[model samples]
Target chain A: MKGLLIKDFRLMKSQINFFIILTAVTVVLAVFSDNPSFVPGYLPFVMSVFALSTISYDEFNNSSAFLFTLPVSRTGYALEKYCLSLILGAGSWLFALAVTTVSGMIKGTAVFSETAAAALIILPFLFISVAVMLPVQLKFGGEKGRIILMIIFGAVFLIFVTALKTGEAIGNDIQAISNPLSGVNLKALFAGAFIAGAASLLISMKISCSVMNKKEF
Target chain B: MIKTENLQKRYGNFNLNCSFEVKKGCITGLVGQNGAGKTTVFKALLGLIYPDGGKAEIFGKNITDFTPEDKEKIGAALSDSGFSEYLTVKDIIPILKALYKSFDEKFFIRQGEKLGLPLNKKIKEFSTGMKAKLKILVAVSHKASLLILDEPTAGLDVVARDELLEILREYMEEDENRAILISSHISGDLESLCDDIYMIHNGKIVLHEDTDVILSDYAIIKVTEEQFKSLDKQYILRVKKEPFGYVCLTDQKAFYAENYPEAVIENGSADKVITMIIRGQEA
Candidate 1:
C-alpha cells in the first residue's frame, strides 16, 4: 500500500504542486473577499477537477501497463485513487476553513461552526466524482474519460438549473412535507454524507478493480 | 518456463492463433515477418490482451490465476511500447525497482552505461535505437526467471546489437533456471542466440524446430526445369519456379543430395528455410 502511494505520488508530483499553488491563491482570495458562501462553494469543485486530472495522467501517459506491472493489486490501485482524492478533499476543506477563519477574524465578524458542514458537503461530492470517473477511466482511458465526464456533468448541471427554476416558480404554494426533526440538521446530514460517500467509493472501487483486473496490460 | 495452449487472439482483421513453449534454460526465438503475430504473442503472454480462446501460462501459473506476486518473476517488453516519455532512464529505474521484487538496480545502472542510454535525458528525447536499448536493459536487469523481448534489437547497428546480445548472454549465464523468448524479424539474431525457433505466419506456427536441425535438415536447390521435373514431388516441400529454372525448398537435404548428385544443390541456412516457408505461404 505504501509502495502504491509512493508510485501515485511520483506520478502526480508536478500536478500536486500545481494544485498547491492554486489552493494558495484561492486561500488568499477567500480571506480577502467579503463573501464566505463563495469560499466553500468553489473549493469542492476545484478539488474534484484536481482528482479528475489523476485519471487524465494515467490515460495520457499510457501508465496502465506500467502500473499493472507493479506489485500493487488492481483493487489496491482503485482504492488508492479514491483514498488520495478523499485526502485531498479533506485538505481542501481544511484550507477553506482556515481562509474562512482568517477572513472572519480580520473583519471582526462572528464565525459559524463549519466542521460538520465541511465533512457533509465536501466529502460526498468528491466521492461521487471519483465513483463516476473510475469506471469511465477504466472503459475509455483518461483522455476520453475527461471528455465523457464533462458531458455527463454538463447534462446534470442543466437538469439541476431547471429544477431550481421550477422550485422558484412553485415557491411556498408547495407545502413542505414537514415532520418532527425533518429540517436540515448538519449532524444528520454529515452522517448521511459519510454513509453515501463510503458506499459510492466502495462500489466504484469494486467496479474499477474488476475492470482493471480483466484489462490485459 | 512459458507455455501456451492453442492461444488465440483476434483484432478485427488480424488474428493470432499460436501455441509454443520456451523451455527452461533455453532461448526460444519467435521468427516471423512484419505483422506476422510476433507482438501479438508477447501481448497475449503478458495478459495485455484477452485471448479469444486458449490459455497462456508463465512459470506454471495461468494469467487469470496470477496475482501481483506472479508478475515479479516475469519481465517483458513489447516491440513498439514502453514507459512514459516524460521519464528518463534515471526516473524509470526507481519506478521499475519499486515494482519488480527482484529488480537489480546496480545491474540496470551498469547496463544503462553499457548501452549508452542517457540517464538525465527523457525517453522521448532519445533516438529509436537508444530507446530499444533502454527497454532491453530493463528486461535483463530484473531478477526475472523469464525474459520476453519483442524485437529487442530492431533498430540497433551491428556494434550495438553485438553489445546488447553480449549483455543478454551474460545475464543468461547468471542462473541456469532462467529462460528467454526473443522475437525478431531478422534471422541472424535468432540464429546466433536461440536454441529452438518457431516460425509463424498469418497467426499460426508453420514450423517449430531446433535451430541446428533447421539449419542442417533444410536445403534450397537451384536446378534446371528438366532436373526439377525429375525430382520427386514427395521430397519437395515448396518450389518457386523462375524463367531460368526452379528453386526448390526441401526438408530432406541428405536424401536429395544423395539421390540427385548432379542437380545444383545449395545448403540452406535458417534464414532460407524461413524465406521458403514465407514463399510457400505466399504461393
Candidate 2:
C-alpha cells in the first residue's frame, strides 16, 4: 500500500505545474470571493479529481501490468486509491479552510463559527464525491471511464431537474422540501450526512476492490 | 521452484494449455513465435491474468494463494509493460524502495549509472537499449529468488543484448538457489544463457531440452528421397520435405553419423532445433 501511494505521489509530481496553478486559483477565489463554498467545496472536489487522474496514469502504457506484479495485492491497490482520495481531498480542504479564515479575518467579514460550519459541511461532500468517483473510474478506466462519469453526472442532473419539475406539476410545496423545518436539529442533520457519506465510502471501496480483482491487467 | 500442470487460458478461438517448470539454480528459456502463448504463460505465472484452469505453484504455494509477501520474492519484466513513462529513474527509486523489502538502492543506482541510464530522464526519453537494460537491472537488484523476464533483449542491439545477458549471468552467479524463466525470440541469447529450453507453438510446448544436449547432441540429417526410404528411421523426430529430398531432425546425432556415413548431418543450434520442430512434420 505504501509503495502504491508513493508511485501515485510520484506520478502526481509530474503534474506539479497544474497543482501550483490550481492552488493559486483556489487561493485567489478564497480571498476575493464572498462564497464560503469556494474554500472547502471547490478545492476538495478538484483534489478528489486529482486522485482519479492517478488511476489513468496507472492505466497508461499498460503500467498496471508491471505494477500488479510487484508486492501489492489487487485489493490493496483498490484500497490505496480510496485512501489517497481521502488524503488529497481532506488535505486540500484543510489548506483552503485556513486560507479562507485568514482572508475573511483580514477583510473584517470573519465569523469563525459560520466559516467552521461551512468547511465542516464540505467534508461530507468530499467523502460522497470520492465514494461515487472511485468505483466509476475503477470499473471503466481511462477514456472510457471519463466518458462514463460525464454521462453519470449528466443523467443525475437531468433526474434531479425532472424530479423538481414533476413535484411542481403535482403541486408539492417546493419551499418546504428545499428548506426543512427551522425546528429540525441542524447538528443531527450534518451528523447524519456524515454517517451516510462514510457508509457510502465503505461500500464504494468494496465495489472498487471487486472491480480491480476482476480486472485482467 | 516454479511448476505448472496443464495451465489453461482461452481467448475466443485461441486456447493456451501448457505445462513447464523452472528449477532452482537454472536459467530456463521459453521460445515461441508471436501469438504462440509465450506472453500468456508469463502473465499467468506473474498473476497479471488468471488462468482458466490448471494448477501453478511458485515456491511450493498455489499461485491463487500467493500473497504480497510471496510476490516480493519474484521480479518480473514484461515485454510490453513497465513503469509509466512519466516517471524518471529518480522518481522510481523511492517507489521501488517501498515496494521491495530486499531492494538494493545503492546497487540499483550504481548499476543504472554504469549502464548510462540517466537519473533525471523519464523512461519515454530512454533509448530502446537503455529501457531494456534498466528492466533487467531492476529485476536483478531486488534479490528476488525467481525472475520472470519476457523478451528482455527484444529490441536491443547485439552489444546491448550481451550486456543484459551478462547481468543475468551475474544474477545467477550471486545466488545458488535463484532461478530465472525468460522468453526471447533471439535464440543466441538463450543458447548462451539458458540451462534448458521450452519451445511453444499453437498453444502447446512442442519441445523441451537441456541447452547442452540440444547444442551438442541434436542434429539435422539431410537425406535424399531414396536414402530416406531405405535409411533407418528409428531416431528421426521430425522431417521436412525439401527441394533436396528431405531434412530429418534428430537428437541422436552420433547414431545417424555411425549408421549413415554418406548422409549430410549438421550440428544443432537453438535456432535449427526450434525451426525444425516448428516447421517439420513429426516422424
Docking quality category of candidate 2 according to DockQ thresholds:
high
lDDT string for model 2 (B94-171, tens) is 988999989999999999999999999999999999998888888888899999999999988899998999999999
Predicted complexes: DockQ each: 0.40, 0.87
Candidate with top TM-score is 2
Runs of candidate 2 with Cα error greater than 4 angstroms are none
Output DockQ, candidate 2. Answer: 0.87
Worst 10 residues of 2 chain B by lDDT: B184-193
Candidate 1 chain A worst ten-residue window by lDDT? A172-181
Q: What clash pairs does model 1 have?
A: A216-B48, A217-B48
Q: How much of the real interface does each model capture, measured as fnat?
A: 0.37, 0.89
Candidate 2 lDDT score at position A48:
84
